[model samples]
Target: MSDTPTEKPSNRPSPVIVLVAPQMGENIGMVARAMANFGLSELRLVAPRDGWPNDKATAAASRATHVVEAAAVFDDLRAAIADLNFVFATTARERDGFKPVRGPVEAARTLRAQAAGGYRAGILFGREKFGLDNDEISLADEIVTFPVDPAYASLNVAQAVLLMAYEWRKAGLERETDIPFTGPQTVAAPKEELHGLFGHLEAALDTRGYFRPLAKKAKMVDKVRAVLTRPGFTMGEIKVLRGIVSSLDYFSPKEPRGAGYPLRKAEVDKQAHPARRAEDAGEGSDD
Candidate 1:
């Protein structure tokens, strides 16, 4: 073997930051600075307030002018994320379940893990004043939020970017985990694992009579399958849910033979016969 030191693998994403209608040229520059601090080099401007290629931004970006000079301008958010495999947004206020919100550290961890799978992921920061609008949030796979004091939860755009970038960098150096979706070098769950998870979920639901009303059975199953497949469930989650099926099946008593046997009998009696079963008929039936 050649004694050359093996090149360490790079965990960095393409990491195009989409700033949607950002205010203040200095803030944009500061964002560039933060990006450089964490080894990120791409910036995409989506209709900035002060205009791109601004001198103020260059001054703030300081020695990181390479990021500023290489910045790309877009008319809207959709164009910015068109070619990316995964997109994440940073927002402060809650937007009524518009997207799944994760803390900064966790979101960064997720980004690095996803990037290891060779995805082109982008982190989007919205306008300074109103932040990302509902339409913009909907464009992202997940939204990342910072944990601040409830009474005073104000974080500047640059600060949020710095925090996310720092966490992502840290995650790249951590040990591997059993969670296939969460390790720096692991890929997303394969199609087979996902299919198995769906089958297990449907079986569990069937056992619980969730697919009630024969008319709606097919439609309901389709809808449920659509949802579980959307976020792209991971191998680890599939394993966990499969375990759930075994646990539920083990405890589901069919013949009344465990600690819960008497309670099960009472439930069965009530459901099977609401009335006392007419005393004369009960006596004759038993005989």
Candidate 2:
């Protein structure tokens, strides 16, 4: 890796976030806050509850004044999004199955890809109490929903805006996680390493007569291997698992499972030279 930091990906004009018939000024302000966090600036309001130039909104914006100041108020939903090339309506529940539905991540990526071709897009968020009526959502080109618990699927107006905005910024970046700080990347263990781990674990289990019914041993081993490998463990995880297996295979304490096993040499060393642990943490606390 290079010692120098790379510049962030160049961004085109972001999607316009339109809030339809928003009830609370604070929620509108927070929507601006969420938008500014992810590099979005355009904000459109349709028949806001308490009227425009809301002082409550400006106070709640938390210094995201630019988005709030430039916000455009509209008489209705149709006129608000008339100029946009594409539009998305956010909903919590599954509606009548006419329009295509998308999740937040896919919707954001689609918006970003379209922006690159000089096309514009907008995301519509309904009010806090009652979301977009069927008539309002019908105006959007597509529907987007959050995969939240069905029992409590409703989201705060600002919270819904935050999710869409976060996904939009993530779509612009190259990293899968799109986080600020990161440790050394570890990839999935190679097949050779995985096979060795399976063999070692099976041998340990075999020695302990773990397969009660001998006829079922092979099927049981297959199941165990399949379950362990399904998660695609990284190389570091493979090492840790092998260490655990080696410990269990070799070390036999006089006490039964009630008493814990002895600490390893590394743990003893850390206890003896406590400062080493602090120095290790000073290397940036990877955990």
What TM-score would you give candidate 1 relative to the actual structure?
Answer: 0.57
TM-score of each: 0.57, 0.62
lDDT value for model 2: 0.87
The lDDT values for all models are 0.78, 0.87
Best-matching candidate per TM-score: 2
Q: List the residue pairs that clash in candidate 2.
A: none
- The per-candidate count of clashes, in order, stands at 0, 0
Q: Write the per-residue lDDT of candidate 1 for residues 169-193, one digit (tens) a residue.
A: 5565434221224324445689988
Candidate No. with top lDDT: 2
Give the Å error, residue 220, model 2.
32
